[model samples]
Target: MQINVNLNGTEQSHDVEPRLLLVHYIRDVAGETGTHWGCDTSNCGACVVWLDDVPVKSCTVLAVMADKHRVTTIEGLAVGGVLDPVQQGFMECHGLQCGFCTPGMMMTARWLLDHNPNPSELEIREALSGQLCRCTGYHNIVKSVQWAAAHPATVGAST
Candidate 1:
């Protein structure tokens, strides 16, 4: 099957098998490997990406399902060489240890902040419940999201 998608702000068309996962299409066809494929069962949020501005686990979504939709991978969070505030927050708060779950965590955080600019700590934890980070103990991840919330202007303006 041939599918067209707006990927990370770029329009792309590719021929893919009906069974191909969106994560595979993003990594192989779109040539963007930032959206990591992990825990194929969707238990790990490592493969999360924005589908038409909402976050979805790419491993659970087929490429054909994403046809004609907008997909934003980790690579799309930046603009003109400036990192999104969430990215900066992660760095400043030491939100990641292994880095495997960083992309999905950031994507989910971005979506949360987009809808709720001032999420409470409990709300942040609830929003991140779906994503598992074996490292960092999640304290810093919550802080990172808090930092991003505190500095919403940077990310909102860029996006």
Candidate 2:
């Protein structure tokens, strides 16, 4: 199958199998390894990515379904070398531990903040409920989202 997906802010064209999962297409075909492949059953949110601006678990979506659609992987969060607030939040608040689920968590976090700029702890928890992290127990993750909500995105010092 020939599919064209707008990845991040760029267009990606690839010839892939019809049954190829979007996650595989993003990682294997497009070479965007930031979107982790985890839990084949889609129980984990590690495969989450923005499909046409809405976050969906790529593990459950066929790559062909994403044809002509816009897909934003974790790599899309940053623009022009400045880290998205969610990405910076994770660092400032120590939101990640094993680093396996960080990408997806940040993806979802960015979505939540976009729709709801200032989410309360409970709302943040609810938003991230689908994502599973074996490390950090979500305490810092919630804090990370809060940090992002406070910081937002602006051009300034990086790293």
Candidate 3:
């Protein structure tokens, strides 16, 4: 199948099987490794990506279904080699550990902040309910989201 997808703000066309999952396309075909694959069953939310500006678990989405859609991975958050504020917040607040789920978590956080720029601590927790972080215990992750909320101009800039 021939499919086209806007990935990381760039257009790409590739031949892929209909059964190929969006995460595989993003990683293997599009060469974006930041989107991780934790649980193939889509329970972990580690393979989350923005499909046309909404977060969806790529593991459950077919690449062919994403044809002509805009997909944003963690790699897309940065602009001109500058880290997005959410990424910076994670770094400054020490939100990640083991680095397995950081990409999806930050991706989710970016979506939340974009829609709700001032999410409360509990709201942040609720927004991140789908993603699992066994490493940092979500303490620093919440702090990072709070930091990004405070510095929305830096993190929530339109792409």
Candidate 4:
């Protein structure tokens, strides 16, 4: 199938198998490797991406299902070569240890923040419950979200 996708503010078209996962299409065809595949199942939330501003597990979504939709990965969060608020939060708070689940976590957090700019700590924890990190870095990850909420300027306040 030929899929037309708007990714990271750019339009792209690619011919791929209907069964190809959106994660694979983003990584292989779109050349966006920032989105990782930690677990094939949607439960992991490691392959999360924003489809038209809503977070979805890319590994479980078919590439054809994303046709004509805007897909935003971790790479898309940056603006003017600057890290997004979530990205800056992760970096400043040391939210990542192994960095494997950072992208997915960031995408999900971004979505949450978009809806609720001032999420409480409990809300942050609830938002991140779906994503698992073996390194047990949840402490800093939650702190990062809190920091992002407090310092929205660094994240550009556009989100």
Candidate 5:
């Protein structure tokens, strides 16, 4: 099957198997490696990417399902050269330890902030509950989202 996806603001078209996973398409065909492929069962949020502005586990979604849709990977989180507030928040708060779950966490955090600019700590925790980070105790991750909430900016990045 042939699939066309607006990936990170760039249009990408490729021929792949009907059952090819979106994660493989993004990495293998689209040549974007920022979106990690982990826990094929979708237990790990490592493969999370935004499809038409809504975050979805890429491993659980077929590439064909993303046809004609917008997909935003971690590579697209920055605008021009300015990092999204979520990215900045992660760095400023030391949110990441091993850096495996950073992308999904950041993506989910960005969505949360875009929807609720001033999410409380509990709200932040709840929003990121799906993503699992084995390295950190999630303290700094929550702080990172909170930092993003407090430091909202006009990051020309697309969701």
Candidate 6:
């Protein structure tokens, strides 16, 4: 299958297997390894990416299904060498420990802030329920999202 997609603001086309998972296409073909591949069963949000501006588990999506759509990975979160607020928040709040789930956590957090700039701690927890992080116990992760919320200017500019 030949799929064309707007990846991280760049138009890219690739020939891939119909059954190829979007995560593989992004990592292998697109050369964007920032979207981590974890738990192929989709239980882990490590493969989360923005498909047409909405967060979806790349592991669960077929590469062909992403044809003609826009996909944004962690690499796209920053612009002009400046980090997005969510990324900065993660750093400032020490959101990640093992770093395995950081990419997905940030992706989901970015989406949550895009839709709801002022999410409560409970709301932030609920939004990230699908993503599991064995490290940090989610305390700093919640604070990370809250940090991004408080700095709307940075996040809004990145988007």
Summarize candidate 4's per-residue lDDT along 1-159 as a digit string, tens digits. Answer: 999999988999999999999999999999999999878988888899988888899999999999999999988888888888888889899999999999999998988888899999999999999999889999999999998888777563245
Q: Whose lDDT is greatest here?
A: 1
Better candidate by lDDT, 1 or 3: 1
Instruction: List the pairs of residues colliding in candidate 1.
Output: none
The TM-score of predicted model 1 comes to 0.96
Give model 3's clash tally.
0
- Per-model C-alpha lDDT, please? 0.91, 0.88, 0.89, 0.89, 0.89, 0.89
What lDDT would candidate 3 get against the real structure? Answer: 0.89
The residue-by-residue lDDT of candidate 1 on 57-126, one tens digit each, is 9999999999999999899998878889999999999999989999999999999998898999999999
The list of candidate 6 runs beyond 4 A from truth reads 156-158
lDDT of 5 by residue, 42-119 (tens): 888989999999999999999999999999999998987889988998899999998999999999989888889899
Off by over 4 Å in 5: none
Instruction: State the lDDT of candidate 6 residue by residue for 28-108, as single tens digits.
Output: 998989999999998989999999989999999999999999999999998888889999998999888989999999999
Task: Give the winner by lDDT: 2 or 5.
Answer: 5
Please give the distance, in angstroms, between residue 10's alpha carbon in candidate 1 and its true position after superposition: 0.5
RMSD values for the candidates in order, in angstroms, are 1.3, 2.9, 1.2, 1.3, 1.1, 1.3
In terms of lDDT, which candidate is stronger, 2 or 6?
A: 6
- State TM-scores per candidate: 0.96, 0.95, 0.96, 0.96, 0.96, 0.96
Superior by lDDT: candidate 1 or candidate 6: 1
Inter-residue clash pairs, candidate 6: none
Task: Give Cα distance to truth, residue 158, candidate 5, Å.
Answer: 4.7
Per-residue lDDT value at 25 in model 5: 94
Off by over 4 Å in 4: 155-159
lDDT of 3 by residue, 42-86 (tens): 788889999999999999999999999999998888887788889
10 residues in a row with least lDDT, candidate 4: 150-159
